[model samples]
Target: MTDTIPNPESEGPSGGWGSVKSIARILGDDKPSPMVLEELARQNKPGGVMCVSCAWPKPANYHPFEFCENGAKATISDLTSARCTPGFWSDHTVQSLRGWKDYDLEQTGRLTHPLRYDEASDRYVEVSWDQAFDDIGQTLKSLPRESVVFYSSGHAGLEASYLYALLARTYGNNNLPQSSNMCHETTSVGLQKVIGSPVGTVVWEDLEKADAFFFFGQNPGSNSPRFLHPLQEAKKRGAKIVTFNPVVEQGLVSFVNPQSPVDMLTGRETQISDEYLQVKAGGDIAAILGLCKVVVEADDAAVSTGAARVLDIAFIDEHTVGLESFIDLVRSTDWSVIEKESGLTETAIRGAGELYIQAERVIGVYGMGLTQHSQGALNVAMVVNLLLLRGNIGREGAGCCPVRGHSNVQGQRTVGIAEKAKLIPMDKLKALFDFDPPTEDGVTIVDAVKGMMSGQIKATISLGGNLVRAVPDQKAMEEAWASQDLTVVVSTKLNRSHLFPGKKAYILPCLSRLERDEQASGPQSVTTEDSFSHISGSVGKRTPASKHLKSELAIVTSIAKATVAPNPKLKWDEWTADYSLVRDLIEATYPDQFGAYNERMFEPSGFYRGNSAHDRVWKTEEKKAVFTTPKQLNALSFDDAEGRLRLITMRSNDQFNTTIYGYSDRFRGIEGTRDVLLMCREDIRSAGLSEGQEVKLVSDFNDGVRRELAGLKVREHNLPRGTIGAYYPEANVLIAIDHHDELSKTPASKAVPVRIEA
Candidate 1:
């Protein structure tokens, strides 16, 4: 095939120095200085220096080579020199900024001061910190407790997250909606149904020893590049790696290790996966069922032939429940239906099953692609079933691994950040502060958006996210924000959320985690949990951009103090003044894993949390892990109707979640734009379309909600037939709120069926 992929030159500086470095690495002209300087410049942006999440405060003693291309972009974008002062907001009305593209808004600059909407001037005006706090407090106090919602993004530090949760619960409202509700809530919800916990069952070390690794619906190259190292190590160790996704990601196929001097100098890329299976969009369930069916058949064959027993009969008999039912379901599943729905032949399914059976230890890693479908919860249950069938759980090098996005999303959940459920920590709060906490389940992100749209939620306090851009159904969320009684956003940089102004909106400037935070107590070291559930200390190397800027912890504390009278028992002031105290409380709350959080975090390598499943100590009610049998066999699929294709949304290498680092998506040949869509050669021909054709894609869901954009040249990719991919945020306009997993409330951005009009 001709290499017509667009050259990196067409893309802007959005990739910063990392783009040049990646290009050099790709072309075998690897030079480190230029890229390093570019990265340094990117980090030393106006407000603070932003490091890639992976590069941030490593174990103080270890020389870790865990950074990747996407990690560099995340760091560079965080450290950009952009600044959006109150003067800028004063000059530009909410209506004016709303006209700018999402990238333009964020790239404008970091927010320098707290701002509040001025009705007379019809623009955001700078306000005193005290005044901003008072305004927010008064508005919140004026509302019925149930009418206010507190929302969190994944980027916030653990301290900030803990405080945000504390503020909402202390205020007698559990109406907390967070970013997790939009991403892996399905894993939590589904896993909780099967296992007792919501977090992953595997540890990082488990990858090294696993006999086989199953990657389900996860693309690590762009989303979580840090995982590449362990995966590469596993590949080198002869572990059979199987990748199942709707699209074939190049990163999964091969990855070059930049950390190895020899490999970097030689420009040799390591072959990653042993096998790749392109399952249909939302067809993971079907593919998993087919695997289970193969396993059942293999077990039956082994028993009949008196060869070797493929089934872990002893493990199943002693450790699980519902095997008979699961076995029956798998035995009854039709191979023809499984093959048609999963887009995989029975042979391939049987091969994968054989690998699973032969392997002594196995691990299944997944991402949002598995959690954002209509049957997302069920999909997770099916994965557990496969592990259970093999007696994989509660064993070394075996269990489920959900590669979470954002820095501290997992940490937030670990430290009682949920709105609906208060852990034992809340009892301590009651004992300390003497306040009766609300016991009602709080709202989730989806419910918060719905509540605002329905007018039941009158005021919103966004601790750190670009709510409108990050949330699905952009138009509806924008309308909801506009109609809210008050909208308050605490952030470091300018973003799309700043444009969605309420009648009374306030933007509070806060210190980014990379900026040194000092108060009367001392400088603070915040903590974050990695994808592997390792909690480490992150101390800022740079000074805060403005004297007025406070830490998120301080900002949240001030708001709580101003809004609610002091509850002597809880001592919120003590924890807010020093983040370590917050960590102490975290330790107390999760004593099982985080005992002595401060001392443990001081370790340079950081510390791992408890993983019962990894130790084969299942925390299930029966004291054993149970395999689940899904009621259905087929995965979700868009009908093969004329002009319709399955559209999956993806993030560019230059972007992190909703934060766009740059416009270029170098891998798929698209440069300088995220508006383009990828399609198969036959689909392009059948639709009478050519490369660079601008067309409208109307959602097959919600009565054809049409979104128009200019299409770029179509490339013949390894993507499955009738499937298309587009960059998110830009393409988020096409996802309808109604089209999501019913159980998790996660928008099905990965599998929206659409029709293209040229």
Candidate 2:
């Protein structure tokens, strides 16, 4: 069970029968019947449940089946008939359940009641909703405002997210950290500083018109299967596609649309990437530096010879600042260093650069691979720098698209989920609520862990997310979490995070995204924002898993009402009765941002909440797009130390963020288990190891910590030299809690220093 099986790798393209089989398996095992197909019809419709899966934008036009294989898995997971009722909780102990794998722990089924950890019996005992809320309020009231951490996740829709943020701010705590703190904080921090926009600028309709795409550090096959359709469509239109990553992903190489009748009938896959460059792990900066070097040098040659200029000279002079420093940095960087650091030959970099400059319009797409690193924010800026060289942003078919992973994470931030006081306008909040909100910066996931370990934070109220499994230094988080005074989780199902019961812990069950959320007003709809900034509405029609479960809006508002002294100005009761009032408050706080919030969210084709950068308007202090100069060239390219190998933690095909759906990784061809290490043949031979050999991986960092992950079986891959890959959550233990980007405070989970063993 511990060792991964060496199943034959899929020779066919991504997403053909494999996807169909997975859909069948998930539906047949978890939810048997064609009823799910009927639900799928209403999945992304104007009045239906939103797929609480990956945040890939729903298409402008709806199809028969609007969801993907993983999306179906997520839906089936929520709508499964199996339930972990009161009897199961009373029978199991937290200490025993902690030993279960993430997959098994979740497969136990949906929680049916609000439960409190009883230390006397060492099991979770069912508690009445009224008593649980009252006891939680008492604990929070006993603690200092600064000592409480209100952590929200992506599962809750916009109304719930907005309420959760308001709850935190009203209680005088600015510590509103969510799942975005792990993934796209770099995108928010990096893109805003450089381009005056925090989100992706490209939409699917416009992206279809692009002449070429430059994909950096994203694996659509595993991370986002829905995105592969666009890549496939673009390829069919004969648009050039180039990819840069340490491993050659199957989806980027070739893909067969499982839904396409012609594809299924012919069994032919459309070629995806015109060119694939195997950049070394943590070497994206060097690769991007090389790209800029090409375009900059080309521009210099054009200027000298009076030939057509490669750089967008007019755009540079008019729209942006810091061009001189950017040019100087690109020109001064050594080609040899770029080639060495990127682990690609100079010829390869030059060829990729040549291809890049030929396209009139391009879409630069990236994902966690770019953001989860030591220089993550800088990594984002570097991509923007390259795009600026060709005037890619604010154009017809070009811009930086940081493909977000978790669902509604961007939407959560759009409403109010932020740590910094400056991000949200406090003056507007004060004007509407008649009460001053907290202005102090809040603790991030990293800081929260440290605070918990030091006994500085006493209480935790989570909307959703598995904190114990998601954070760096897994052992440390598990140990530190239980030291607090109280812990409360608002979720649909049980997760590893629920196991960490402090002095008093309660798991408050909430209605799942697809379940009907009825208030006094009637069944209500919730809103969610996608990766491309499109707002949409979802109305859940399914029956509630349990009558005891409450809506997140009710839970958050009730908690706020009980914990914080009643504010006469804020209508906690009315907001829960009708969500429109909540939207009104949100719009009032930022009138220009979410004006007419209720009317626009449910449009047949969701409206885009436009980014200023898309219109060539800069929101920065300088009122112009700025070029970023990195403090160090090719920083953290991870040049090898004596026994070190650059380790890249990746997600399996059946996994989404911290949630592992199954044991098999269909894309990489590993089955039955996730405990495996994948490295190039050369690395395996050099390390004196063979395929299927069970080996240990010891992380090597200079922080006086050497973390070891054993029971990992070795398997040769086509990955670049000196770099290996392992499944995440398992490998999360190797990352030190302190290893993160200073600007974003995002844990560097993508790349770590490790040494392989025999």
Candidate 3:
């Protein structure tokens, strides 16, 4: 085995002309800039604000170029003149449309109006908004409260998300699963349990001032390119940036800032990570544990010898609990176990730890790589423990930062969207809206599929997102969806989820964040929260693709009014009329925190929803941040079977969540394909496979059912010996419904045991 994999020679620093080329392609494919100049002008004419792509906090002083390449693609895709009209649907049957790729389906165009699937004709026909809402209302009234569930996407605004949650509860159901369940549920659950906060404590400004940053399980280059700016600035300022992952991401390798003309023109690049360690899949716990062990040993040695202290004794003693027990677990853990699990030598772990020991201020940032595991929650908690050792929390340029991949995932949760009832009490709802909310736990994504399988949940309403394409065990999920009595999707474009029709299904078109949403009062502005808990306003400027399309808030209010009628106190109509009123209600529900929601939202930089952990004010039962001792290190174990390997699912640079932007992942040097499996050369040879050889992958699971995907091409890469990588949604088939984080129910998409056959 080699100590380091050879870096590709063909690769160049990110954001040279490559970003311009990609953006041009996106604009060219959807609508040439010249052709859609009017649409672009309409979208940014006046009083228009905020980038529609991501929830990254904006600067206090706004600029015309606040958007990024990805943001441009997202905006162009939304405002595309191409239309998926009734004629287009008539020409392409549902079965026929299924053959088109996810990107092609979306590229076909913006959904023009509400549509309903007609089984007889095998096509979707246009329907009046009134008729669609009538059907949704009737179906909700027909089913038992427990049998009806509402799902939300992270792209939704705070006002709409709040209304959706309120509507679901007032209608007597708490099955409000969201896209966050698949991504950042671990952050919410783990942080809340440990520090009495469910969101990241550090803001964007902290990254600029940090002395060091540890990035784990996240690829900022492809996932969020805007992040590259701050990372590059930190690197230029001499901050040590360390990365841990199974694959080396180019964006983290080197970035030539596109925003900086000098760097782009001169080919000057800023190297991002100081050291990149390729940890095994699900090996984050072991790796962090080993690093912590090194730091603790050095600190203990220093204290016993009466040397200067390495650990922050005062901070730990005053602000944390369970330290002695946590220290015992880390100290007593054998090095051999850590070595075997982490796929890193003791020297490597200690080398990384030395940075922590030397740094005056440190910030830790991670993505799904830490959260998409069976022990995902434990992974988050362990990171918190690492920071606590040095008084990292409650300080500038230092704290825990879980890079929420989605735009407003943190905000969606804050607006009271949850599966568990105890988390959001019924009493709070009763006082705020004068309605008795449900008081029982509801089904999450996996459980919702189970309910459908058992003939319990008969209907579903998705605020946004491609649920069928996003969940695990696609075959089972598709079967479960097929058995539903009714399914309704509120969306802006057509995707794979709409293809899986229940007995009665409807695709209701809604205005996107980039389009002007005119309510009864006037053009509406909605608020979204960033990963750092800053809530800012997003006011679209373009006209709706179709006049018939309704706003998400309006759709929710209309449905609520029709289904849960005779309730005047709820004021669903008023909330839709003026979004500020919705903010007022949110303020009432969370008085101390959202007390000034409306005023703060309009502030140029937005305002932070104070995190107790940021101020060292732990609100836990112990009145201090608690150190959690996980039961074990890694939750996955591969069989001794010869060809067995740990397989992890990931997104390409061309994709966002389940939305496939294209077939190429420019960062990984992969072009024109998503069917390729990245594996170490040794592993490929051991499996009797050559680079570019076609093979079949079968997942190993406790369930008797066999889940396999064939015709996958093997590609030699720098992954760990026993680990392989594949794009998600396509590889989601390998993940079993039962394989998820127990605490948060997040699917272990990053680690799955499997076998490959030539």
Candidate 4:
């Protein structure tokens, strides 16, 4: 039997009954019994807690219904009553289950026991935690420090990340490959170079006060649903919302506030984007430079005509450097190059610039779309450059806002999870943990992949995440994982990565973020940082899916004790007992920002890790926010055969990172399937192809390796000409791991020139 694919809707409100129906479907399907449903409801109620989904800071005055549809799905996904037993694994061989889809694997429910792969039986059998830890410890201890790498997922809490960092450094290995290496490494590198901080300067509340919002490569409706509320509010208050993306996302086009009873009942929708510029894939850098060019030219006219200057001359003179060079580059850039590279007319670019000039305060928001390209760092710098010109930084309702997709990705980085050992000062580790940390830099996700192929990575300890599936070049990633001597995955649910075992592999089931974590002290709370650097405490109410499941803190502590020779001064055991102690230690490590950790942790309003750029306090070497003079925008070349299209990998509404919730993408009108590639009708005709035609896509690579994805159905889309959009992870196979950004090492997943085959 074949699956039926639904047609894409031409128009609809972002969220209303669609969100409600989705919530019902997920929760009802996952937890059928009345008793289970009641328990799930109890877990979702607001009682001074945080949402388990994306890390947008909860307001000081909490609403009873604070969670969004995605949050509900994420929470219920963890609240699932189903459990995978040892008997279940015995019935299915690893090779047999290899045919399962990502959603199918997640639907198998929580991992109920610690299991180790047995070569003789070709199956995973239940094992004691001590036995698993012992094997892992012995293997790790035997290997040279450089041979082992610690890869962390962003799903874990701050406490676990801090402990994991300590464990890695103490074991004399600093090779920590993190999820950030895949997602926002460019944001960190690019923003840090200019503002001395990688994170966004604007707070959550600033959105309400902004006069205009320029969303670049972000769809708040899907990636971060909580943000839609703020955008809706900003729209209601007469703020201009401009969008620049390859695809016209439903969330950015129009939205019906699910929180509003009147809007929900009447189907009254609020138009989101006043201007939607559909830039070509990998064209964001050129588009932003073009906008800067308009602003610079406008400022020049304002100076001559005695009009109010668009550029912030006072702020530029006092708080920035290299403005002249930046303006010169923008001026010298050709109009034809901007138009061709951006896939937008000069009139449109200039019009958006006019909107910027008209507004007193503006916020710039972007996502992975800008940072998943070869020129990702330059793309980020361009956004910063645009905002810097108008004095968007150092003011309320105006700053660069990078929407962090994961719930705790930013928090993990805040609490000592970094590839660079020096990112967390040695003095802090020495004073707090009393250990002389390794000075050598650690490997990132990209580095780990290269290391694995060369047999440099002997063992791997993963905290959470489907690491193999998330990386590009799927076949290569799987082959590399098979070469490891020991691979340990500390996880809650079953994923594709667990099936591909090393010579010795162990699956250590851990408590989900939605489950209550009780320890020696009492119910524990973990902290997470939002995209805007607001830190809040989240405590789950649901009972553990399995009594055998351990908290991440406990898992890390046990591993640290078994592997690293115990130091009386380290206090790993004590830290596990009460997470507040961990927060206290974290505060001790960074006393200035995290002072009074316990008190701040309980703050209903949460604590803000202040940004120097927002306050006009530059920490740069020049003692000011540096105006980066990027090279002039070059005319983009697809360099592919005439009928070829540039493909940009995208996420479905039902997906978050590699976690597939359902088959449908409600926003894009894709239902019941992820096998379709969205293409422009003209491109389809140009290639002499028809809609619903099955074809193979062969990626053009610089490495001379043939990477082809077969059996992809083409569907007509409203995409810009010469570009196509396909679901991520599935399309990730086309991205060559070696084809990555030079500065950030992030795979160029957003831009892949491909030729269609019959």
- Which candidate leads the pack in lDDT? 2
Off by over 4 Å in 1: 1-65, 422-425, 620-623, 635-643, 703-716
List model 1 lDDT by residue over 612-638, tens digit each. 666666666777676777766543534
RMSD value for candidate 4: 3.5
Instruction: Evaluate all candidate structures by whole-model CA lDDT and list the values in order.
Output: 0.73, 0.84, 0.82, 0.82
Error in Å for residue 735 of model 1 = 2.0
lDDT string for model 3 (166-200, tens) is 88988888899998899889888888889988888
Q: How do the residues 1-758 of candidate 2 rate in per-residue lDDT, one tens digit apiece?
A: 11111223654577888888877777666662346677777887677766888888788677777778778888888888778887996568889998889888778778899999999888899999889989998889888999999998877888988888888988888898888898889999989988899998888776778888999889888777778887877877878888888877887877888778999889887778877888888888989989888888898999999999999989989999998987788888888888888888778788878988999998899988889888999899999988998899998988888888777999998888888888988888888888889889998888898899899998889998888888888888888899889999987788998898999999999997788889999888888888888888888878888888899899998998888888788788999999888888877876776878888988865767788998999887789888988776543535568779888888887878788788767777788899999998898888888999999998787778768899999987888898899989899899888888778888887788888766
Better of 1 and 2 by lDDT: 2
Model 2 residue runs over 4 Å out of place are: 1-8, 32-34, 635-639
Q: Which candidate should be chosen as best, given TM-score against the real structure?
A: 2
What is candidate 3's local distance difference test score?
0.82
Model 4 spans with C-alpha error above 4 angstroms: 1-11, 32-48, 632-641
- The segments of candidate 3 whose C-alpha lies over 4 angstroms from its true place after superposition are 1-6, 32-48, 61-64, 637-641
Residue-pair clashes per candidate: 22, 0, 0, 0
Error of 1 at 696 (Å): 0.7
